[model samples]
Target: MELTANRSTCIGSGQCVFTDPDAFDQDDDGIVLVLRPQPSAGDELARATEAVQICPSRSLVLSEQSA
Candidate 1:
């Protein structure tokens, strides 16, 4: 899966981080930083999807890999 976050839409609420700290983190300014852009591993994919679903700002987006 491919994951992307729109910084402009992120408010640094940390919901994504709360869902998966390994996949998401906060910058010095408290903005969200996506650690994994395209997660190929199963565990990473799950965490990335969770982060996307839990983001209150709808900043995180998860897309399936296209053939």
Candidate 2:
């Protein structure tokens, strides 16, 4: 899967970063930064999914990678 972050709607809650620091981070203004656009399977994917679900502003998105 691929992850994307919507900076416009982000509230800087840092939930995504907290959930998966390996795949997510925050900029100087606290906007979410996608460190790993395509997370590996297994534990990485699980954490990415959890981060998307727990985002307070719903700024994180997980989508199927294109061929």
Candidate 3:
């Protein structure tokens, strides 16, 4: 799966960082950053989904890989 963040919709909330520090981080301004553009399955996917749910700004998004 692939994770993406909408720069326009982001509001410097660190929820994504809180959920998965390995998968997500924050800029100097505290905006969410995806450490892994293409995540492997298992724990990574779980963390990604958690980040998406916890994001107050709803900036995090998950997209399935195309066949």
Candidate 4:
């Protein structure tokens, strides 16, 4: 899976960080930072997707890998 984030619109909620520590983190300004943009492992993919789905600001986005 592929992960995408709108850094400009992040709310610093930390939901993505809490959901997937390996795939997400907080920057100096507390914006949601994408650590792993493409997660392939089972658990990693699940957590990344979960973060995307649960983002209240809808700044996190997920997409299927392109062929």
Alpha-carbon deviation at 5 in model 3, angstroms: 0.4
Cα lDDT, all candidates: 0.84, 0.92, 0.85, 0.89
Per-residue C-alpha lDDT of model 4 across residues 1-67, encoded as one tens digit per residue: 7799999999999999999888889989999889899998798888987898899999998888787
Candidate 2 lDDT over 1-67, as tens digits, reads: 8999999999999998889888888899988899999999999999999999999999988999989
Which ten contiguous residues of candidate 1 have the minimum total lDDT?
Answer: 36-45
| Tens digit of per-residue lDDT, candidate 1, span 6-26 | 998899899888888877889
Better of 2 and 3 by TM-score: 2
lDDT (10s digit) by residue, model 3, range 1-67: 8899997789987878888889888788877778997778898888889888888888888998777
Of the two candidates 1 and 3, the one with more favorable lDDT, higher being better, is 3
Cα error of candidate 4 at position 8, Å? 1.2
Ranking by TM-score: 2, 4, 3, 1
Model 4 global lDDT (CA atoms, 0 to 1): 0.89
Q: Which portions of model 3 miss their true places by more than 4 Å?
A: none
lDDT of 3 at 53: 88
lDDT of 3: 0.85
